[model samples]
Target: MASSTKPPPVEALKPITSVSASPPRLLPTALSLPPKWLNMYSSFITANQSSVTQIESALRSLTYIIPGRFRDAELASESLHSSIQLLSMYHDTLLTRAISKLPGMPNASLHNRYTKFWIAKSKFYRRIATMLTMIQYTELLWEMMAKRKGERVRWRIIVILELVKAVCRLCLLRITNSRPLVTPALPERETIPEEEAPTEEEEVEMEEEVTPRVKEYKMKRTGLSLPTLPNPSDISSYLLSKVLTADDIKAPNTLLNKVNGSAQLAEILHIIQPVIYAIAMSRSKDKKDWQPWLLGLSIEYAARQLRKDGLRTTALEREQWGKRGWAMGWWAMRGAFYENVTKGFLQSTSERLPSLVSGVLDDYKYLWDEYYFSTSSN
Candidate 1:
């Protein structure tokens, strides 16, 4: 019989690995987690955002329903609105980190690459602008409260806030090199946080998905390495190359060839108009002086026209413009215009209406007269 040597023991049959063999590639095991407390807070706030919004809306509507006789209720509603806004601002601070972690386009086209590069470059200023806006809005609420408190320093505070905002916009303009400022500065991220950490199986799936590409990338450079043209689809290499370095990404160029000088000017004027109004108010003896109204309205009208002429107004800009237009109706309440024009019109209209409708109109009129800041554009 052939000496059938039993197959080598299973352990001995195993192939020997070289001592210098490359270490196993480490794969990311899980998605990054924010601080536990922050995760919980953000998760709670984000999950209830819609409910909060609904509650706010209810509060606002309550102000309309509550008669002027209930002054405390009206003030309470206003306070709650301001409190909710402060909470929203706090949420915004946490949002920035989430936004930073978002993945970039790995296979961006030339135009996309340029856009991404500038956006990344301007990220800091954009964040500053966002913070300033939050402060401005929050301060406005406090300023209204301060006015009620008979604080002599409120005017100075308003002037300083407006000036600071103007300066921030100027810096933004300089950074963009006169490019149209993106309103809101940052895009909205998901309000809802992740409900659960990824499961082990999901993590393994993600590892499997990512590992092959990494291995392929290594395999491509394994042998006969040579200087080859950078792939246009490879965003990392493109970013590292001289192309982005040589070009001025922030140069005054139309975004998608749609923006124009008119848009830029409109944005600038829109930003500074509040400052102009604040200055006029500070100098004037009468808070509702026609001079300030004329000055503010003129600047605003010019901005609106320039924006219209640009033919490149975003939906958001258009919406804001519409809001400004509505706010202009409030101008009738300012200066002698309300005493001479609007007051008579309202009186006549209310006289003709039924008692119930007239009562509602009177409540609204009370809101208009008693709480000027409620409808103020600034």
Candidate 2:
């Protein structure tokens, strides 16, 4: 009886449309705008990185100007500074990735190997550097929380954070094999647009030019092709070649030679200076104790002098060191020096200055009085 029932005619049978067969529902404008805006912002940052950096720098400078006249002003300034730092970190991350994808110089030289190694190493170190920066920006917030608990807790937190930073730096030093650590950890790569990249024709021409020179070099050599010689095809051995060692891969040297042991000691001193200060502050009964200042300043000054003697720093390095020296002036706002000398000097100076200038000084003085770390330039 069932067989006798004829199958439904093909024309009568309608195809069943599953729910998924329908086109995807468009996201609401409000829901979609955030991602779109974020993409646009990211693109803008990528395109005009230098300008963005300048803006960030300017904002940071403004934070310094926006004195801690009241609790609200101090909070605002700190928030602004931290936001800028975070934004810079984000931009730097994007730039790092962009630089990573860029093609190496279109030449068969040791430079290609060096670029490859540096990019990879820089990627690893950049993460550590970013972590250190994160710790720095969040320090105030952490201290604020710890202060609610106890003074000792706050100081301990500082010590711990500083120790972590020092340990991370030590790790970086080891990674560099005692070489000078670059500030950003990521080396700056020249941004080459697609049009700027070498064309196939150019690459062919380069190969032609390079081949003859290499052949001539081989011909000039008196000895047999030694097994000890690096195979150009082997990346590890190629990088380890006399012309391009691991040290060269890690960072550039302004001078011809590698940094001496004293330079390494200087780096160590720089890394541990904050930790020494934190420990001293934690142990000291007097906030204006001279011992902490003496220890911290002595170590810092020695480090600076040793750095100068041991290595020929680049202009940028010298500038950074100079900033550290300027920061040392902050010590006058702390310790017995501040109590005995700087406080009275500032008071007298303010009295003689114009009202506006005196007001500004008073604001800064209040900040210095209220916060232990307010004078920290970094």
> In model 2, how large is the Cα lDDT of residue 332?
75
lDDT of 2 by residue, 301-338 (tens): 88888875334444445545666777778877776678
Error of 1 at 234 (Å): 37
**Cα error of candidate 2 at position 90, Å:** 2.0
Residue-level lDDT of model 1, residues 218-272, one tens digit each, is 3455655444446668968765664643223433233323335776678788779
| Best by the lDDT measure | 2
lDDT agreement of model 2 with the native: 0.67
lDDT of 2 at 211: 43
